[model samples]
Target: MRRLLLFSGLVGALASCTTASESTTSTKPDRDPVAHSTIVECILYDGMTKTSPQLVTVTAGTEVQITDTVDYYFMKARVVKDGKTYSGYLQRQCFGK
Candidate 1:
């Protein structure tokens, strides 16, 4: 009777351990869409003497809609206008691209 109880306890502990490990391993990481929207409304500049660039003063909570994915050191973005829009490229790090 003692041996049987010990064996059952061991089996239950092992089963729970295996279930916990399986749950952890089965989890998938969150994925971002290939093309998505982002809002970056700031200016960054690389100075001749500065090792890293600096972000210039920008309006607080400025929201500009970015309509594409970043695929280069610089990414092109368009500014919305009533009649026409202007497009330009900004450094990837500046906008977390």
Candidate 2:
């Protein structure tokens, strides 16, 4: 019957569709550890982008706690200055191991 054929086609189509549980898992290379480090030279930005406003000029020898690694060039860092804690994105190259 046409109804039976339609039902089978619908079932076939449903089977061909991806399931909700089926997801793609992207595996990224392990990032180098950079938990705590000192600022050698750089400016801390309010955001991760280059166009973001500069929060502060991190002087050399300033201590920083890396909260997150955004990418190859930037990391979210926290610095304590004058009893105030500032959080922002800093250039990775500005920090020393």
**Who wins the lDDT comparison?**
2
lDDT of 1 by residue, 26-50 (tens): 4675543223233454453233222
- lDDT string for model 2 (32-65, tens) is 4345655576788998887999888878887787
Cα lDDT, model 2, residue 34 = 48
Q: After superposition, how far is residue 10 of candidate 1 from its true place, in Å?
A: 1.6
Clashing pairs in 2: none
Window of ten residues with lowest summed lDDT in model 2: 30-39
TM-scores across all candidates? Answer: 0.29, 0.58
